[model samples]
Target: MNKVQSDFLSLLENHRSIRHFLDKKIPDFDIRRIITAAQSVSTSSNGQAFSIINVTDQEMKKKLANYAGSQKQVEDCSNFLVFCADLFRLEQISQRLNVEMKKVLDSTEMFLIATIDATLVAQNTVVAAESLGYGIVYTGGIRNNPEKVSELLNLPYRTFPVFGICIGYPDPNRIPEKKPRLPLGAVFYQNEYPNFDEVYPYINKYDETMKEYYRNRSESKREDTWSKTITDKRKIPRRMNMKSFLEEQGYPLK
Candidate 1:
């Protein structure tokens, strides 16, 4: 294969989330370079409505670990970063320019742009961290209690926590297995989404593959096929209240 194709295949085939981490600390220069790479991502309209808070304090990491669904990686990892979607900077700019901030903050389109900006930045950080030999995990559970996370991080109005990322050296003793993904044909469609008639067979095979993967990799032997996992999560209504939580956090979503 060509070099680009070889690297792309390596990246796709080897990507795995590492939760168990060694006690070693990552150096400050590497952290700075990784974050610089993250900041190099293209932002929406160059607004750059995102910021990352590096949490190095042990006490704060402990508290954040609790905030993020009691995930031990939050405390055990060498570094923790809270990625935030921030409109507050633009609001400040508006004040300095004597322009109205209300119009920008109230628009749903602006909110989406800010969210996209944050997500892009976080993903860039993940890739950069991985390339530098650091293992990383994205903690979506940071939003399990948005208010609590905001309070812990001292987030100002118009800035919301998008997610937390933990980065560190992986513990050699606890090597994680590479998780399987759906076949490319299952997700890719020409010009439109594939109909169920064209997709269900692939999904069924994928479900079996996932089941076998879980059986081998997990000690708990969780009977979570892809479809069953999706059904189980959707059946629970708790994650649906995220809209109200976002509104409460000053998104306004108008």
Candidate 2:
């Protein structure tokens, strides 16, 4: 590979979710640099329908941590960014121009667009932060009590917290080994989707790889295959109120 390709791939392959952070604060300039890099990423229809709330206040972070299933990383990181899929700004623009957007805003497609936009921006933010030598972990636990989190952050209508990212300097002693990923053959395809019989081999191979991974992990070591782990996780329904919550938040998704 060329130097640029090799360097970028190296950065991506080295990623591991860091839940432990040092007490040092990230510089303001570095924060701005990370956000700027994130903003430069592509947005759907050039709408840029997303907002990021950077929480640094200790008290606020503490409350957020509790709301996010007591994820201490939210409170301990130098910065906790809540990425919101936003349509409120679009509503404002419509009001200013004397146009109607209520119907459009209620469409499921629009909701998907905003959510995808926010996710894209957040991924870019991760890349930027990691490039600057910062450790980061994404917290989907924020969705456990999205309403409470929204209240704490004072979020307006037509917006929802998709997830939060905890970014800060890593505590070297706390870093863990990177988890294994499924084989590319299982996930990648040519044109048509492959038969299950063909895919099962790849899945079985990955299951063994993950079984080993969990067996040797430093903390919370467990003996489990990836398939079993995922089945156990998904068999139980979670966040069943999300649809109702989204409707209440002005994303009726009609």
Best candidate according to TM-score: 2
lDDT of 2 by residue, 1-254 (tens): 89999989999999999999999999989999999989999999899999999999999999999998989999999999999999999999999999999999999999999999999999999999999999999999999999999998999999999999999999999998988899999999889998989999999999999999999999998999999999999999999999999999999989
What's the number of clashes in each of the models? 0, 0
Error of 1 at 209 (Å): 0.6
Predicted candidate 1 versus true structure: per-residue lDDT over 129-150, tens digit per residue: 8887799899988888888889
Query: Model 1 RMSD to the real structure?
Result: 1.6
Q: Find the candidate with the highest lDDT and give its number.
A: 2
How much does candidate 1 score in TM-score?
0.94
TM-score of each: 0.94, 0.98
